[model samples]
Target: MSFDGEQYPGVMAPPQKAQGFRLNHTMLRVKDPEKSLAFYTGIFGMRVLRRLDFEEMGFSLYFLARLDDDEAIPEEVGERTVWTFQQRGLLELTHNWGTEDQDDFAYHDGNSEPQGFGHICFSVPDLEAAIAWFDSNEVSYVKRPEQGKMKDVAFIKDVDGYWIEIVQASKMEGAGR
Candidate 1:
């Protein structure tokens, strides 16, 4: 499979070698921890798996994951840290303590002039239902499911202006790069 980073225009699966490697997480530099945390946790239903603070660097990292079962997450710090790294496809939010106070603080969203990174994708069980829920919650959608050529694919923007693709698990084919 040739993954080319274009939803519906490339292979959805990664190469065989990629199978041996797991994507632990994607880190996003957030401006406001409160807003970013609320958006992901409230809308995406991702729970905080771990939190790391660097006082010297004046920054913090929040690891989040989507839980499907009642499996209790490790409570101990060391156990949770180990378990957090074992999970695949987790989201990490990095908050620089002073960014919230900076008037011009902003991270490259990988969509404009210098696009270095692409959007993250989430596979939902029901595309229609998820879309309805997003609409009811007044979520900012860059592209709705039925609006583009790829009817089953959609894109929503996070609080920091990062794009997130939402697709139904049943329609996973042609929804990735």
Candidate 2:
């Protein structure tokens, strides 16, 4: 949908013209690959669509996706690498080798002083059930529903301390039956 700031009778005005570009993925650096992988693939049910290791660079890239049965995921590594870039919404996790051993290792979550980046959200069919699942898996929560002003919303923290907001799909804006 291209919008040149033209107004439609039943639609809201676009703030600016869209450039028709798609978001491929959001990258996050992880320290412990095993822990991060377990959290994303085991607990969250996301499949590792692609895994690329640069041995000389001392880092690896893992692309994950929440795919359905109808979707086509490549089997061969070369085709998978090309296919991974084609999807719009995928999570890219970069594991820098040897970083997990540093005693003072940490990454700025962008929520502290001079805050900039916020959180990534996931809409669930049942927010309560999702919260329970997270709890069952011993995942840490940044903000629970009952503790926030927005009682219907909740936030959980990933292993690297990145926030993930959880919202009820049926209750969220623009969601319908």
Give the CA lDDT, 0 to 100, for residue 154 in model 2: 89
Looking at candidate 1, what is the lDDT of residue 29? Answer: 94
- In candidate 1, position 76 carries an lDDT of 93
Q: Give the Cα lDDT of each candidate.
A: 0.90, 0.84
Candidate 1 Cα errors over 4 Å, as ranges:
1-21, 173-177
Report each candidate's C-alpha RMSD, comma-separated, in the order given. Answer: 5.0, 4.6
Listed in order, each prediction's TM-score against the native is: 0.84, 0.84
- Tens digits of per-residue lDDT, candidate 2, 19-117, equal 556789998888888888989888778889988999999999999888886888878889988999989889999999998898789877889878977
Residue range 55-143, candidate 1, lDDT tens digits: 99999999999888796898999999999999988999999898998989899999998778889998888999999989998999999
In model 1, state the lDDT of residue 58.
Answer: 93
Q: TM-score for model 1?
A: 0.84
Q: Cα deviation of 161 in candidate 2 (Å)? A: 0.7
- Evaluate residue 59 in candidate 2 and report its C-alpha lDDT on the 0 to 100 scale: 95
Name every residue pair that clashes in candidate 2: none
